[model samples]
Target: MTTFYTVIDWLMVFGYWLLIAGVTLRILMKRRAVPSSMAWLLVIYILPLVGIVAYLSFGELHLGRRRAERAKAMWPSTASRLNKLKESRRIFATEYSPVARPLFQLCDRRQGIDGVKGNQLQLFTTTDETLKALIRDIGLARHNIDMVFYIWQPGGLIDQVAESLMAAARRGVHCRLMLDSAGSLQFFRSSYPSMMRRAGIKVVEALKVNLLRVFLRRMDLRQHRKVVLVDNYIAYTGSMNMVDPRYFKQDAGVGQWIDLMARMEGPVATTIGIVYACDWEIETGKRIFPPPPDVNIMPCEQESGHTIQVIASGPGFPEELIHQALLTAVYSAREQLIMSTPYFVPSDDLLHAICTAALRGVKVSIIVPRGNDSTMVRWASRAFFSELLEAGVNIYQFTGGLLHTKSVLVDGQLSLIGTVNLDMRSLWLNFEITLVIDDDGFGSDLACVQEDYIARSTLLNAKEWQKRPFWHRLLERLFYFFSPFL
Candidate 1:
């Protein structure tokens, strides 16, 4: 019996070694970033079986085989329809301002979508204003209303929006609502979706979480794109989820969330609607968007309209398009770069680019909320403050509210606004949408909004930042160490 027990122990040891070797070999073959790969290796080797389980659950971008094949199969038809939609709307090559041209060119070359002209934009900064405008549009919907959000917490003014959608459905309007399963876990657990479905609205959840299938994909992968298309004529996209600030996260003590949304019209809306249609089709296995009209509803009135390009990024895309666009924007900034986001934990390349931009004498400003809801995110974000401040980048902490807007204004000529944050999760994990606006008037408007945020914020001095508690710095460093994996 003693000999048999010894043999069993030896076999157990051999099995553990075999498992670790297999995981290590797989990680090496993946060819992820060196830092990321090293981090995973460290975790897998250090924690016995826990690290391997964690990596299996979270490390890979496990877009299911079915979804991957479906997305591939849908691309050709989607691309052709997108081209026809753009062409029918008379989208021409935009002569972007010199400062913004290269960024546009990069997106055009990679994304296969150029700037569409004659887009009229309205900027909304407050929750009341955005909700009112969106509800009004839904109320006026004639044919179709498509909406997607990362989160849709019920109650408050959100109920009004739901009522509007129900009324639109009653009026014979086709309505489709897509929500991220993980982000909207509360909503799905509640009775809202059933109510919407009973009202004849099509509600689909993207990236549904399943514990049984954890190894198949990362359960944290979220559909973070917030978009609303009404009648295929007007569109809305931004950092705002379908949650009212008053009722959402009140217990977190971060105060009301301040967000930014853009109400867009003209040809750009159709392009954005195409984005929605593609996502909707992927989620539902049904192509729902109607064919493009023979005649353009709105002609290209170049003199008075804004030129906008949509840059959608996710695991489905190639080469990290959004991150590249952001890097390009930072590199292209000749005068000033203003960025505002609730989360600021960026990858090494983006961090290096921003620091380099400031070191090269570009006036760089970063604005984040003073009180963050996530303790880990707060520490991770603050870890790089010393480096940023040393590089002469102006860092401000907004005290007014939880500044939830994600925007970047470059040289007062180009602006990027959408649901994407500057964090690794948003930049790498989540499906995000960004609108690149290359118009002087629109850039100026967004700049003014950012200026107001600055007015409400307190700028941090390098010396003062260094004076924080030692434990705080320790926590920041600890979290920063794990940021690449986060």
Candidate 2:
């Protein structure tokens, strides 16, 4: 009996190794030199079981047949609208800069969202302003309102917004709300969803977590997008969470949570509406009908000289458009590159791009929080800072508050702003959206914001970084090893 058991165990080990080898070979064939594919191959070779689990959780890109069927059933109108946008872009010969044009072409061809026109943008810097604007927009909803947030807490400022949404729903305004299952788990267990539902609001948890659904996809691929569309003519996107001052605790040592959110009006709003509709369709099998073509939507007027393109990325998509766009933009930067993000676990290609850009005489500056909520992520981020500093990149830590914004200003002529973070999850795993604004005015405005953050921040010299406690540095090194999936 003992001999038989030993033989069975050996067979199982051999089978596992064979499976890992086959999967690694398949991944290499599918993705040419993508960081994600390479990382998966390494993981499978170094740690077979963990690699297999990670691959199951995040390695697969296809959303499977059930999701595809549900998407088609729920959002037939949205699909039609996307087709129209594609047709429109093909007719126009809109030109983008070399760095951004490739990404635009890729998204337009593959994702069915075209570069829209006639849109006006208003940037909000503070949470107070953002919430006020959000409430005002909610109050102005005439037809329908669609909102998706990663975090939605009740009481205080968020409660006010929740009440406003409920009030609008009571007035017969069509309202649909989607929140991430992981990020908004607290709100899900709370009375917010039920209360909104009682007020005639439709609330759906995006990417419901279930062990049985493991084959469908890992629960870690969260919908980190924050989008609000009203009446198909106005939309808002940024990094602001739906919590109030109490949650961030500004009065405490946590500092203020600064963010950037832009309100857009024009044909671009329709594109944003399509994104929300897609998420809604994916979550619920019900699709919201888009507005008729005759709806007097104007072209996006240029508020500034900068041209802007919106990039959306996720596991459902074939390519990581935003990540590719950032890498391309960073490589294209001739003078300077300034970036601000809450989490900063960049992929190998992005790291090399920044370092190589700096080596070529381009000024590189990264603004991060002094302390982040995620200990592992912070440690992993620190492990890379020394190398960046050594490569002539300047690092700043915002001391006033948690810098929750994800933005990049390149050469003062281009700006990339939106909900995506500079982390592996945002790059390859999570659903993210970013707007590549080509307006000099918008870029200048974002640069001013970054400057202000730097003014309130403390610069970490290479000497100071090296003086940190030995154990702390060791922990950071240890965390760096697991950063590929973080």
Candidate 3:
């Protein structure tokens, strides 16, 4: 019996070493960012089996072989469809300002979708206003309505949007709704999905979670994009989910969640529609050739409209395109930079870019919610504040509510607004979409919104912030150390 126990112990020791060796080899071969690679190695060596299990479940950057292949297969048709829009909506290299050209080229050269001119944009700052706008648009839809959201809490104004969608479906307008499986698990369990389906609305869940398929893909890589398209002419995108702040997360004591949405009209709406179609096809295995821009339906004044580029970022797309683009914007900012987001855990490169921008005399300001839903994210975000304050970057904590708007404005002329948050998950893991607008008119409007947030926020003092309890500082450092995984 003693000899048999000794053999079992030796075998277990051998198995542990084997895991260490194999995981180390695989990490090196993967060629991830140096910081991420080093962090994973530390976790593996220190935490033992738990770290290996975490890495195996989440370290990989795959979307499952089948989903990846489906996305690859659809690329040709998607590219072809984009090309068909060139003669009508595409802008030449010389049409936009020089400041916008580099960022535009980064996405255009990689994704083959250039900036489309003559896009009319309306920024909605309140939840009730945005929902009303969506319902009004859905009411007018004659052909089709495609909507996607990360969270779909069914209550208050959200149910009104649903009733509007159902009415549209009954009126013979084809409507398809896509919800993230994990984010909207509550809604899925409710009767809303079945209710919509019975009303002739096609409902699909994106990135469905299955425990048996855990080895095939990362279960937490969610579809975090919020998009709504009506008749391929009017589209909406932003950080706002399909939820009423009055009814969502009220118990968290963060106050009402404030959000912003951009309602768009013109040719660029078709571009946003393409994003929805790609996501829909990847999940449903159905090819959809979205109709081209209907000039008669949503006419544009080419000389005065906004130049907008839609960046749909995810696993199959170019890695860190939005992150790099944002960094470039920060580096190019000669006058000022303003940013707002609920989550603000930036990557090393992004953090450096922001601090450098401030060090170089550009007025850099970041607005974030004082009360965050995720303790880890809040701590990880504050971990970088000391460095930022030292470099003259101003941090403002909004006291009104949870500021959920995700936007970046540079030089009062260029603005980026959409689902991309300033965090590792948004920068690397989740599927996100962003709109790069190069119009002084739209940028001015967005700047006003940021200014309002600043007015309502209390500026963080460097000395006061540094006077926090030692344990608070320690906790922040600990979370920052593992922010890559967060």
Candidates' C-alpha lDDT: 0.88, 0.79, 0.89
Off by over 4 Å in 2: 1-55, 58-65, 68-79, 86-114, 248-253, 292-307, 467-472
> Model 2 compared with the native: what TM-score?
0.87
Best by lDDT: 3
Q: For model 3, what is the C-alpha lDDT against the true structure?
A: 0.89
Please report the TM-score between candidate 1 and the true structure: 0.97
Model 1 per-residue lDDT at 152: 93
For residue 273, model 3's alpha carbon misses the true position, in angstroms, by 1.4
lDDT comparing candidate 2 with the true structure: 0.79
Using lDDT as the yardstick, the better of models 1 and 2 is 1
Candidate 1 segments exceeding 4 Å error:
293-295, 299-304
Instruction: Report the poorest 10 consecutive residues by lDDT, candidate 3.
Output: 87-96
For each candidate, what TM-score against the reference?
0.97, 0.87, 0.97
How do these models rank on lDDT, best leading? 3, 1, 2
Give a tens-digit lDDT track for model 1, residues 250-316: 9999999999999988778777877787787667778766557433555534434788989888766
